[model samples]
Target: MVFWVFGYGSLVWNPGFEYDEKVIGFIKDYRRVFDLACIDHRGTPEDPARTCTLEHIEGAVCWGAAYCVRGRPEKERAAMQYLERRECEYDQKTLVDFFKETDPLRPALSGVIVFTSTPDKVSNKYYLGPAPLEEMAWQIATAVGPCGNNRDYLFSLEKAMFDIGHEDDLVIELANEVRKVLGTMAKEKKLVGSPLKPLKSQTQPQIPTVQLHLLPPEAVAMDL
Candidate 1:
């Protein structure tokens, strides 16, 4: 059987596994938000980096890349193992229908796997939930870890999306805000300092509702 995985964050730019094909597409009713915390890859436990996770909202459409793995079961197993370790921070493996850009009304593939975190902060230790734009920007600007700084991750995602011809406005806004914070720090000569405390959680803006196009029974089926 062919295995497919959908990437919306760093995986969109740096998929560490081999695949038979990569298709640019979108999933409906889900928006990307930088509310997940990363303490291992691009941050330390004391100062976790904020990363993207899918938030369900009516009418939202998240553009990303869907990778197809075929040929051998061993190869597919290897790919899944790599992703499991790489995306350890995400607490859930969600399956969604993928719609190609050319034909948004119909699904190109079904049961496309997407990694996401649990919404309950108490249940998911790495779930950061929602916060003010400024607070998120600050955490993203200052966090660093074994892999690299958090800002680089944000900027890389921004560039990757732009290169794919699907620029995400929320990503651009947060990246710009991080740049502004970094600029202020540089001017004040405060690049090196004690870690900033995590900001209090803030409510996310309500997503306006819109009627979603109904999918056919075959398209909505999860049995692949």
Candidate 2:
């Protein structure tokens, strides 16, 4: 049987696993939200970064990529092992119907899996749940970790979505708010207008170029 995994956030840009094929797909009845706090992986415990996760919402659809691993059980096992290690915070796994956007009228692909945690999935200490956009922005703007600035994660994911011609309004709005807060933080810390740039503040915050090997242009262009 072919095994498939769904990616909606950082996984879209950095899957960190090999697969036989990848296709742009959408999962119904759910939406992506940056409500989870990245305490261990993306940020330090003292200053955690906000990250994305799926929330079930009727009539909502989440656009993402589906990875297919087939032909060998060992290959599938190894891929799952890597994913589990990478997504340790996301403890819940659910099988969902993933429909490729290339053919919306057709049935969903076989063997689709999504790793997510709901509010009722027992209160996760890292789960931030819902909060004001400005609050989230401030947290994201100020947090940095071994991986990098927390805002970079948000910026990169937004760019990835835009590269596929899928404009996520929520992410755009949050990024704008985060930049505003970042500017304030820079000024308050006397890090702005200096020869040496602040560690957290970007001079222009341009979108970094990314080559999406997993999501080909044609595969996701239909989503636009």
Candidate 3:
């Protein structure tokens, strides 16, 4: 028997599982977006309401990898353990698994667990990466690099969508549109590109201003 998984988040890239045949699987009415809010892995571990959410992200698409595995009962159990080890921090659930389901031929069973949102919090992820709209698109578009957290799920979606010529509203929102100008300044010592030759803006670029870590909205919420 073969096992398949429809990955949407980091699994799109850094999948720790050993499976053959990685393909671009699709699910109708469901799209991938950087919306899940976390607290332990990406954010501070000391915070409460660390629950993550899979909120409604408009015009968004996430690209995931599916693989086929061969093994016995023990192997199956090991695979499940592996998934938990990788995504245990996210806390996956059957409800989210339903959203990730695809076809049987391309059937991806045993959906990896992930942290879900608080249901009361906003669904859309915090736009902590870009300040403007255009820049956000670019970031999502060319966010991939040799090795990094930003290049996994988000890049998969952005790249595949571009290849398929699927540009929707979420891909062209007002907030992301304004981010274009903010990106040209050069992040710092060259996370993506080199410094200006003329030494323009002698001021060194800030780190937190460039890199983004997804944290639960609760972490930043008021005490009230």
Among the numbered candidates, top TM-score falls to 1
lDDT of candidate 2 over 1-224, digit per residue (tens): 67889999988878988898888878889998988878876788998899999899998888888888887888888999999988877868988888867776564775588999756425677677889999999889888888898999999999988876676888999999998998887787785556774676565687989986787788899888
**lDDT: which is higher, 1 or 3?**
1
Sort by lDDT, best first. Answer: 1, 2, 3
Question: Number of clashing residue pairs in every model?
Answer: 0, 0, 21
RMSD of each: 30.5, 25.0, 22.8
Our model 2 lands, by Cα RMSD against the true structure, at: 25.0
Candidate closest to the true structure, highest lDDT: 1
Per-residue lDDT of model 3, residues 1-224, tens digit only:
55555555556555676775666544433443343333334343232111112444554334344555657766667766787665554434432232223453343434533333333333333223223434444444333322433323343444544554444345335224424433544453256566446555656785665778877788768543
Candidate with the larger lDDT of 1 and 2:
1
Candidate 1 TM-score over all chains jointly: 0.84
In model 1, the runs with Cα more than 4 Å from the true position are 190-224
Give the runs in model 3 whose Cα sits over 4 Å from its true position: 39-63, 95-118, 121-157, 160-224
Give the alpha-carbon lDDT of every model.
Answer: 0.93, 0.84, 0.44
Which 10 residues in a row give candidate 2 its minimum summed lDDT?
Answer: 117-126
Answer with 2 or 3, whichever has the higher lDDT: 2
User: Candidate 2 versus the native: TM-score?
Assistant: 0.80
Cα lDDT tens digits for candidate 1, 1-224: 79899999998999989999999989999999999999998898999999999999999999999999998889999999999999999989999999998899999999999998888889999999899999999999999999999999999999999999999999999999999999998977764665566555534566889998987889879655
